[model samples]
Target: MAVSLTASGAAPQPDDAATELRARVERFVRTRVIPQESVLDAGGPAAGAALRELRSLARTEGLWALPLPAELGGGGLPFSVYAQLAEAEGASDHGPAALGSATLLDVTMLARHAGTRVRERYLEPLVSGEIRTCYAMTEADVPGTDPLLTGTRGGYAADGGWRITGRKWFTSGAGAADLVTVLARTSGAPGDREGLSLLLVPTDSPGFRIVRELPVLGAAGQYEIELDDVRVPGDHLIGEAGRALAVAGERLALGRTLRCLRWLGQAQRAFDLMCARAATRSGSRGALADHQLVQQHVFDALLALRTTRPLVHEAVALIAAGQDARTEVGLAKVAAARMLQQVTDSAIQVHGAAGLGPDTPLPALFRGGRAARILDGPDELHITTVARRILRDYGPQAVTPG
Candidate 1:
């Protein structure tokens, strides 16, 4: 399906096919994935089994891997089209993984930079969901958002391979990942931007170890990994040596965009829950929905969601067209993260103590909303970057007293 451009340069409305696919995804998440959240959260062999069954069902229903290429066993939808679908899947925290579409970032990066040998070994399996991969760039002592402080090193080996040593924290999905894409310094000093490079390390390699699983907001899955002189084939190097930052930028832009889309979905879910609670619950003055205070909360939540969705779609459209989207993405990332946090917090207030309990998804969504501000790139980073970029357009003296 083709997506036309509006007069304002905004994204076109979804065609009939896109709308149908989105409804199918929503139904699947609501009926199949939501019912399995308890099992998925318990984190055991049974959870894994249940998730695998869900993935199989998603595939059977033709709802798997919507963003990947058709030749790579995906639905081949463009990012502009997939943005809406992603929001639907994002309603449940486990929706993306359950539907087998969470590997888009890794898959896109590898397809662009990996050599024939590496691609032949990993790409197909990753695309087909036969194996999972993780991106390990952050370190325990340094801020991951700043690539210049990278402490990991990969030196030449006598056997023509490379010996890599580093420690990374917040490596999501590492416990179950088969391979990890590591960023290491190959020729530059500690703060030099020119000497970093990307390497593909198999989880079974000699010195690779999972130190511990690092929980975020009390949820498990992220990990702290240690690589002590792990040796990888020379051919495992991705793209040119000393160019990791450029390749990583490509992934981050799209990653942030996808994240914004997901955050909107979560915000919408929380908003729905809030309204339902307000309508059904009893308060001092009849139904909670009848209270002016309750109406204000609903109105504010609706405003945040509506304001943030278009910014996300604009960023998605730029990314899909291969245009520069740093500014738009920065705006969307911060806006969506804040929107989710606000809407979810309001939802929790509307539900009173029940929102904090295990019976509802508010607690999980609240935690995710809080983390969304800090991950990918923190709010401060994006704010600073966007401000400086915008300032460049008016020159230093153009805003004297305006």
Candidate 2:
């Protein structure tokens, strides 16, 4: 999966097939997916129907699961190439789910770490979109900033199984997920990093239940779930015992990188909307585009989009080649999140009253933009972590002794 770079250290241009696939995905998102945003916004049975229809169309169009493995009914595109398509596919929030790439993180993690039985049972159906999954790590009372604070407990059952008991909130898609990958303390006490383990618990398990819907900005999907001694066989473990954080670290790295690319795509969408609004909407003097302040918005949004893209792609390159890219991914994640918020806010400004209304997608995009800052690690955490990592590179000689 090594990528070839030019003399200037830039990645080589994508081949024709990759370029063609990207174009097809862009067109699909623009045409088929964008039109259904209103339905998705509404939520409920109609939205579910629309999503299923979109997924069927994606399959019929030969664009389903482009980033997953071909043997498992995916396009098998490499991350380096799929990174480009991810931006396009991510333009609509529902794009990844509809096209089957939504399972990339879970599928990849399970394929590499899950035991044979777990893989045999879940992998193919997951790839084919027959079932759904969600990751549960954050808890109701704990600061998600630290994984070492996880309080969920998983103990050995009398019959060589495991019994899990804990309550996890803000678990996205928990209502619809067939399986939830839960992080539990297997041996050590809270704050001990050596004892955490991941257990794959089926939603239909005896004691697993969704407590309530935890909405974000009046949107539904996130839920508070409780596992009251939920039991699963011993083989349900993901990766080695007491090494859940290590497995989670790898998963989050790729997940964050994908989120960065998707945020850029959403920002680009907002930028386009802003420019279109500026050029056409007549104000007191002339079209909004004539205003110097409006011009500044255009310039700033374009600058942020263009500049942030390279940082994201840099992270993508390193990740595709299986290299350490913590700094690059952190930089991309923060930059893209801020860029989306800024660009979407500017777009809302241009549209004025209409942007705040439900008629346009600006409000929904804005909500996602704002949440992007908090999800997948907050901006402050990334800023702090990235700084510490960079400083460590300078070693002892660069450190000043007090």
Candidate 3:
């Protein structure tokens, strides 16, 4: 309701509603969500119970799905305003999922491209936290950098439905998902970008099977799965046939931008931890904060956080305005990811061996920081792609933003 902001990421001055929403999210995450993060990380009946209770509390407190469409039972905050709150909501890895904003990308994609029947069946439940979904695009041995080499194939079945056969790995939350949005080649040959399409496949489909758990750096979330002729209705196709890349590209741009913002939140969390440790913990030379080396860590972490915030918010602004944001998003993605790793690493150093242990969240934060660089198109990919795009304009007209 009445969402407004000053320069997107800058501190809000006049928007009471926006500021209030942000404060509420920060308070909820710091007080309610962060406390239960360890329980959620442990993964068991208690974790599940804690998560359900937290989700219930989120709804009770009116903090659920603030970034989704109001018609779909969310608070309907625009991207610009939500971008600010995203930092707060993203302080914890579980924040978005707990508050329901985790569905933003999928919901946006489905709302724009999915058929009426598919939307009617899934959107409401997804937003209300009644069901969970995951995206499947990467293949077992194929490099994820090129979607044109997708090994998954979807073809028409004798029953007039679509049959999908593929092997996918690194599918996050696949083990517990009720549905999965799969990318498959419908008519394209190898190395051809055309003919790829997105399909909505129910996890309960007759031929769908989970092969194994893919633990990233020893964490339990991603999975490897096999779809052996899993079939779905004709209307389950997302967007136009042969245009999945365009649809996916749109989703990915926003998804990457959102991720950058979340990384900033996480970096800030790490920075806070580092500062607290530096101020209180003492060595033979006195408090850690009093040392020049420790102060350098604080200064460098602060500089990174400050510099990366504007780049991220610039990308957010472009996306909110529905403009080309590839350049901005690419820059933000790499910057925010590295910042997270740097800040978290510094934080771990300040804590000494204690950071590696499970006593605090530093170990998990550091792990995620390392993983962030590789996920959602690695830092190398973004750097090279953005550089290439910028260079191509030098031969002719000057470069324009994308």
- Window of ten residues with lowest summed lDDT in model 1: 2-11
Give the TM-score (vs. native) of candidate 3.
0.96
Per-residue lDDT over 1-402 for candidate 3, one digit per residue giving the tens place of the 0 to 100 score? 453335655433327777787899999999999999988987879988998999999999999999999999998988888887999999999999999999998899999999999999999999999999999999878998888899999998898889999999999999889999999999969788799999999999999999999889988889999999999999999999888999999999999999988988889999999999999999787988999999999999999999898888888878898999999999999998999999999999989998889888888888888999999999899999999998888756776556
**Better TM-score candidate (1, 2):** 1
Off by over 4 Å in 2: 1-12, 398-402
CA lDDT, every prediction? Answer: 0.91, 0.90, 0.90
Question: TM-score for every candidate vs. truth?
Answer: 0.97, 0.96, 0.96
Please list the residue runs of candidate 1 whose C-alpha ends up more than 4 Å from where it truly belongs after superposition.
Answer: 5-11, 396-402
**lDDT of each residue in 42-106, candidate 2, tens digit only:** 78899999999999999999999989999999989888888878888999898999899999999
Backbone clashes in candidate 2 total: 0
In angstroms, how far off is 160's CA in candidate 3?
1.9
Clashing pairs in 3: 326-402
Arranged by lDDT with the best first, the candidates are 1, 2, 3
**Tens-digit lDDT track of model 1 for 70-167:** 88888888888888799999898899998878999988988889899998888878878899999998998998678888998999999998999999
* Clashes per candidate (backbone, < 3 Å): 0, 0, 1
Off by over 4 Å in 3: 1-14, 396-402
